[model samples]
Target chain A: MGNTKKNDRRDFLSKFGTAFIAGAALSPLISNASELLETENNVTEIKNFKGSFEDLLGGDYTNIKLRMQDDVRRALKKPMKDRKWAMAIDLRKCVGCNACTVACIAENALPPGVVYRPVIKEEIGTYPNVSKINLPKPCMQCDEPPCVDVCPVEATWKREDGIVVIDYEACIGCRYCMTACPYEHRMFDFGEKYSDGLPLVANYDKRPSFEYGKEWDREDRHSSPIGNVRKCTFCAHRLDEGLLPQCLTTCIGGANYFGDLNDEDSVIAKLVSRLNVFRLKEEMGTEPNVYYIR
Target chain B: MKKIFYILWGIAFILGCIGVAQRFMYGHELANYGNRVVWGLWVAMYIYFIGLSAGAFLLSSLVYVFKIKMFEKVGKLALITALVTLLCALLSIWFDLGHMWRAYEVITRPNLPHSMMAWMIWLYSAYFLLLVLETLYAFRIESGKYDGDKLKSYQKKLGILATIGIPLAIAFHGGVGALFGVVAANPMWHSALTPIFFLVGAIASGSALFTLIFAFFWDNKKGEYYQNMLKTLAKIVLVAVLFDVLLEWAELSIALWMGSPEHTAGFRAMLFGQYWYVFWIFHLLFGVVIPVWILATKKNGIAIGWASLLVAFTFIGVRLNIVVPGLIGEKIPGEASAYIQPRLTYNYFPSMMEWLVGIFIVAFGIGLFYLGNKYFKLTKENNSVKS
Candidate 1:
């Protein structure tokens, strides 16, 4: 009986040892082959390897990715309700310094004869009882986005992130979008350059840590495909880096706030909850991103 | 007589060429189009020409489908004018587009359901095809190439097609008007009646234009049939002008009654401000009242011809008033009023390039018209022989 048990133990030990050795041997070979395949495919395997292993180990990277994907899926699955981003302007806080207008123009690198942001000076009452209100206006970035709706080429679209962006390459310069926009925020890029020294401005370079969104070689202003309608992007390029828009940063009166409305703790969320905010042209059903506070 | 026609066409062609050159070199800066007046004379001209095309084609349909033998001489001429005017309308839009090269993208990447202009593109293309087919059928009949049996059979078939084309023409112009009417942003153009008004105006202006063209042909001794044609056309013009007046009055009255500050201000600009004279004297009196009076009261052929000339002349002004004033209103209160005056300091005129291109297109149209007339025997006798 004792002899039989010893033989059995030896057999078990040998089988276990061989299986371990085979696994160990095959792992490197498989990994190396995959690495070679990755090189051939011009893809870095490290990027793919990250979350898969983390998922197996229940790590935070996997959790975050899953959570983000779920959130996106859920948001998309739901019916479009209050999907439009809106802003309320507090007429009480705005001062007629024109800082926001200037900053927006500088950030957008707007050519001569184009103004992306403009402040309207209004007198509310007669001379004695008159209250001067300086209203700074940007592209309303409407939910319905009349500009996007009317673009014949589907060149302009509302992003999942709540900004309307124009694909310069696809736009046909029909100007139908400009005519459709009630806010009149849309502008035609008429191939005007800054060489005439009308206060030359470069918006992207003005920021300290600007990353190019789309690859465009400098020295070709016309390369952006002129004749397409353009408007304020709410500083989408800046937001990608967790930075505020140039207009929001440079507002002398601190009238503008940029934040995620999804976050309850965000400044915009808090202000919207507390203040009586109103959008321009609510009757039009555009559900604009910009709001005004009384 | 042919030499004079050629001379006049040549002059117009040269002027149009100069306009196109100005546009190409300097951009729309040559035109009196700015932020305030984003649409101006070119857009007005586009609508005017489109109206003329639609009107002339509908008249030709009367001869084709209704078998109006008295109107036979002007039928081919109407078709030619319709085709030519359609070309002019297209040229005006081409000039208006900021990126003319990217025009093909409008078709290749069409945004379905949302774009009114895209719908316009498709509708206009279909209408143009219908016009081409109709023109060919007319040609075949006039040339006597088809025997009586074939001609009768073809006419029977084409008459049905021509009937379908009348409503299509109405829809085409009405759709163009709807393009503006649907833009709720511009209150002046946002009325439900806008499409109806556009259709009515189209018929009125179209009849007026045909009257003028026919009278010119008659005066030049092109044919005696034009005199009888003008007499019939005068009655059509009178009715159209009266309807146009009623619609204009109703549109304004509704705006006034609405009592919206923007609508009121826009109406005031048309009635009393910079556009007041254009609204009152040009569009109202000359376009509607005076032309209607002369057409209705005058019996003399020369007087009727002059009345038609007045109608044609003033319709251009009416189109301008329709397109420009609404765009010129305040986009946002407390901001600068979007109104633009036609002064050199504030606005632009069509530069040489713009003129040249415009001339080229007009010349091209006339040249095509002349070629069409020469190749096809466009006379009553020829048409009768085939039938």
Candidate 2:
């Protein structure tokens, strides 16, 4: 009886998908019409993506951030499980300004020594032959994330949207995950603020930054994140609100790109499609979502 | 002499309390581990103490499982040492965790099977329970209430428990090695031989601990039987020490032969880096060579005790060598120098708070052992040896 019911449900779902796809394919001219129209979210995305002819090209549109914001809006139309968030950084455009680093700290309200994204600037070759190279390192958010595997308490895991998130409440703060991450991406929050060793901490030091769509208040000294392992979530909270990651928008060099890899039209999907783009420690077989066009 | 030891222990206990206080008040801010070298003094100490527990337990198994008559007297004492050292190991690691309060989550919401660390916690919890049960039965058998048949049955029961514990001890301590070994990202620890190396090291250090305690503190050490027992332990320690060194050489040689910098970087840093003395002077000379030479040749009980102490204590240098050097080198090229903050740098040395807390833990363990010995009269053997 159970098998018959399961088979029926599976058959119905497949049949329904087949009919809808077949009907959608018939309208070759209207192919670009919203697959997202099935959900209310997809309808809202069209409004966000479309504008007047001049308005489309205007509004301080210096670079890819504006274009990527539309891609984010489109991706947000789909259910989170269907969306695979990714990032691509063009090394040629990066000037090693450390703007992304500062922006990340400011956005996350990160305490001293807790950094999510650090732009590693290296000057290759001897002094006369020296040339600079910049690499903005974030949590690789690996398909096979070593960090998730080592977490004893099941405190951290990769979400369906390709973001690895930590349940601060559940974390025993062993920092085993920190050791396991090949890229050295995870940071232990020692509960230190910028206002540490001062007479009184400033108000900003106590303010919470929303991560994973939940406010993480550092006001209480012995609370969750204060003594927890923290890492980049690709601005998961901001993604829910159809905004690009803080580092992407604040990037002075316009070197960073963000979008959904699940969608063929998304910016990151197109960027990473190029053969020149590569991932960090590809030999480690982490299958990192973030790629670099070096 | 005892008065001097007590005074120093008292001083260490006081300092330890202060260290615990600072740990609670400041969190990991006072710790020097940072992002690069995530595991530091406490982690090394935890592994060291656990190794001691595993070693002692295995030694006790010789009396119960293998039915060795020579080590029968120290069976209760061995079980007690294993229990106390296990407690110290747990406490050391508990202090290391970010949220010590949430340690229960490891049992409640563990990432089982996949995580070697989770396996370690589960394995040790079983080991801890087994140790407690075996110690209780040893106490029962020691009470001298039962006649020959009942006593034999109890010994049989103990034999079964110790038999069960042999693999449990090996699995957990070997699992600890496998925990580091499984992290393929760190080439230094990612080896098939790591688990075997750990088991051998545990035997070497744990047997040395048993020998040290038996040689110096046992009540009937002046007796010919007691002296013979110490001599046997010296031989066991000699064999174990040699076996452990052989495995170490195999590990080092294979990594060097591989010729990958990622594999060799940790070894290079350990042998020739800033703290070369930790490996060469402390581990090689004091931990291995001096101890090995004395254990092999010395018949004097005092000399054996000193040798055992050197192996047991300087094994921390070995533990430190195992942990810190693996993390000293950068994963990405130019990554260490990429960021300039003190926390971001590759260099690490434990802070004052860390050292104080470490002293406190060892002092605390000694305090417990002292109490346990006094309460249980662990020095008194079940069957008195005729001099």
Candidate 3:
């Protein structure tokens, strides 16, 4: 018992020592990381200095993120019916990196067979004339959604705030809506995991996802989301939490924009009006809320 | 021959049980159908079997509604076939659902006025109830088994039920077609002609199945009466097939001649793609030419029996053509390649497990019919002279 007490004390002391060294080592990187990705890539402005430097040379758009955050904070104060969620993607800025796709997968805890957003790539020409285009497709959240009309059970519906939401508990997974959606955005969850054949399911695969603001643990194979069809919700949970979507947070291009279209002053609304923007399959009359600024 | 057939059935049933077990344990993972080509063999089979049920029930209408004396003996047998096949259709579609248990939601929280599938379910429910009533009345008032007022009451009830069922079957089966037709996204299935074609195909396939069942299984002596019945049933089958074939030709020709890639993609793929034999050989040669030739040439029981069987079985390939091709090529090109995974495939053929499960539905349907026959005596229970 005396030996155990000594060992425990030593272990505690060592842990403290390691944490102090690690914190000291990471302090500089942490401060730098906060300012590292804040500016637009081309920012070259000289500004009044706050630090010891003669002048601030760049980072003109460093506070742009804060401004967007403030916009979201203000929007969240309004009633649900008064808010209309929408997205604007600048196609010229997208480099086809697919960081947004990866981040979305992480955020949703998507299994192997299910995906909400995938970056669609196309190479336009041959050899020296080659140019590539990337289109990141998510659920359109149409005002007149064909998917909503095709479901035998009323498992999916558009929210008052304009996000299309599926009740995983109510979805029978018939996949009728999948066929009806011209964009083919809805994906069926075939109850697969990343570690399907392995002895232990991957750690992240077991993580609970907060979708539709509900805690969904995918440990049970015969559970709600497993046997149900799923789609993008525009990261409504994060919107409710006054934060940007994981896709928007991770997009290296600064191409993805999300805000309320109902608020004319919102970023998405401004982008839609300022640029040559259009929704996919406008002839289908789905009234898609997502717009692409080409 | 009978012993050999029973042994083969036993083997198939055992294999089917393994498939059913696999489906329950692993879910859709063991199945080949994925997100892109969402419907597969089972969906084809669901429509095929449901078509057969609708056809068989409609064939019974000749006896009960139209009061045709020639088709007097076919009513009960047709009803039994209808019931059994309908049960199989329900089973096949239920199994296709990701959450089979939640299928009750179609009834509980249905989205009607917008969903053709919801309309289909409601119509099917009504049809199922009417069918049960009609079958009960038919059974209770069997031939040479009812008295004066009892006979009239049973016949009157049966007549009323059949009258309701005719329109019910058309609406439900047409609604099934409309279910595909209404999906304006898929240009191939969006045509207004789809529901009409489905109705006629159901009659063609369903009546043919009933005729085949009657030819071999009915416990009637191979006399003048039997030969007359076979001739009449075969003629009905032949006419229905001709009508269905005509409609099919119109669709193929129009789609091919006015070849927009989007509209003609499914048809071109059906005719010339990898699984061309499904359309050319299975559907055309076996389903149409051979059956039509045999049926037109002779009216013998043996000849009509084989011809009807060919038409009934090969119609499955036709149903497959309807489902798979519509969803085949990239509706949006490169969208399939946009995300790479096993289930995100654009091309599909049924896996072995799928075929095995199909066999199970058929075997289960036959088993139920056998029990229904033994208990209810839908057809006369007597010995048959094998050729």
C-alpha lDDT score of every prediction, in listed order: 0.67, 0.85, 0.83
- Candidate order by decreasing TM-score: 3, 2, 1
Highest lDDT against the true fold, candidate: 2
Quote model 3's TM-score for chain B. 0.96
lDDT of 1 by residue, B252-332 (tens): 998888778877766777788765888889877877777788888886667777788788768877777777777766667
What would the per-residue lDDT of candidate 2 be over residues A1-294, giving only the tens digit for each residue? 122234553344334334334443443655433332333442233234322212322443323456679889998888889999999997865767788889888888888888999888887888655556889998888999999989898989999898999998898889888878889999988888777778999888998978778889998778878889898999888988999999987665556888999988666777788877999999999999999986
Cα miss at B384, model 2 (Å)?
Answer: 6.6
Q: How well is candidate 1 docked (DockQ)?
A: 0.22
Interface RMSD of each: 3.8, 1.0, 1.0
Evaluate residue B10 in candidate 1 and report its C-alpha lDDT on the 0 to 100 scale: 86
Best by TM-score: 3
Q: How well is candidate 2 docked (DockQ)?
A: 0.55
Q: Note the DockQ of each predicted structure.
A: 0.22, 0.55, 0.54
- Runs with alpha carbons beyond 4 Å of true place in candidate 3: A1-34, A37-42, A45-64, B143-145, B381-387
What is the Å distance of residue B374 in model 1 from its true position? 4.4
